[model samples]
Target: MKIALNGRPLTDQTKAAIQALLGELARRGAEVQINDAYGQTLQEWGVMHPFTSLYTSRADLFDADFVFSIGGDGTLLETVTHVGERRLPIVGVNTGRLGFLATIKPEEIAQTLDWLENGNYSLDERVLLHVENDRDVFEGTNFGLNDFVVTKTDRSSMIVVHTWLDGEFLNSYWADGLVISTPTGSTGYCLSVGGPVVLPRTNNFIIAPISPHNLNVRPIVVNDSSRIEVRVESRSKNCLISLDSRSKVVDDSIRFTVRKEKFGAQLVKVKGDTFLETLRSKLNWGLDIRN
Candidate 1:
């Protein structure tokens, strides 16, 4: 088996767990590849080994059977960009707080590897949002596994986002910003702004306002197939646009559209894990102190 490893900067607490996982993979004769950035970090920490292949670009991940995303949910999202349209299955290891996407724990690394070797895992396909504009916004990849956000720039007052769905006028949102989230992202920024949590397979998009002037305005769900067009008018000359973790400043005159991507991200689901279970555990869904 061939595996690609990618992640953010590792902390002292996670170093030992990573070393143990790597050692076990080596003992099992599985080929391991590490992203160049992570490889450099490991080398600086005196943990780089002879068995690991280092790669700097997505082209180097062509032969990987699976990609291991270490760190938190944000790290897993970054992994999706590397996987791109190839639809490579990613196994997320949580070494950060509130890991909604990176559900696997460091203690479960060995067990998870056993399941993978024994063919006891399934793939969860997650829809991605693609951003379109007259000119390049996000260079190279314009798709995000979580959401696309439009907000006012710093020191700017609230912006007006004229939104349309499938060419039909939706509403002119007067707020700090707007969020267009995929079902997979319902638990993220959208949820913070009162968006309903839709099941991952629901094939829906959430349009949630951020600090709307009208308290009665609520988040609305739309079919994933619907095209969402947004034109921003801000007091400042520019506004901020973010696709997942990447953010950029754009002119208020720029108009952009978002739609569901043709291909989705594939997440590896090990046996005994379910989304409902994760929700209950991570969010403390049914827990009550008064009980």
Candidate 2:
């Protein structure tokens, strides 16, 4: 088996865990390949073993049987983008807080690996959002595993967003910003703005307003297949549009249309781990530790 490794700098504990994992893989005669950025970090650690190869492009990711993300859920999200339609499985080693995507714990690494090696796992395909800025207001078109946001910057005036669904005018929103999210992203920024926690497999789209000026205006949920168009009308010359973590300045005159992409991201889940389990663990649901 071949595994592709990518992540942020590992801590001492994480480094030890990685070393142990690599040793076990080596014992099983599996090859270890590091991503270009991570390969450099490994050299700084003074490891003498040679990496199978250093990968900087998505094409290199297709060769691996699995991609191991060593940081947090963010790293796993970044890694998932590299797989594209290849259906490459992701194995995340959580090193950060609130790891909804990176559910595997450092202490459970060995047991998890044992199960993975023994072919004990299932997959969950998460939908992705496609953003089209028809006016070329932002940079090259990008994809988001989370949500896309159009928000007012430091400007004092609130922005007005004219929204439409399937060619039917919805409502003009007066707020700081707006977010259109997939079911996978509903738990993120959407949740912060009073949006519901949509099931991962639900065919739904969540439209939530950010600090709407009117108390009567609230978040709305629509079909994922619905074509939603938004035009920003802000007093300021500059507003912000973000796809996941990537953002750029855009003129208020520009319009954005968002919908479900033709393809979705294939996420590799460990055997028997369900989305509800992740929500319960990450959100501390049903936990009563206070005394």
- Candidate topping lDDT: 1
Candidate 2, residues 18-44: lDDT per residue as tens digits?
777677677777777888887787678
Clashes found in each candidate (C-alpha, N, C closer than 3 A)? 0, 0
How displaced is residue 68 in candidate 1, in Å?
0.1
Those runs of model 1 whose alpha carbons end farther than 4 Å from true positions after fitting are: 50-52, 289-291
Question: What residue pairs clash in candidate 2, if any at all?
Answer: none
Off by over 4 Å in 2: 47-50, 135-141, 289-291
lDDT of 1 by residue, 8-126 (tens): 88789988888887888888888888898988888787774544678887777757888999999999999999999988899999999999999999999999999998999999999
Top TM-score model: 1
- Which pairs in model 1 have colliding backbones? none
Candidate 1 lDDT score at position 272: 70
lDDT of 2 at 48: 46
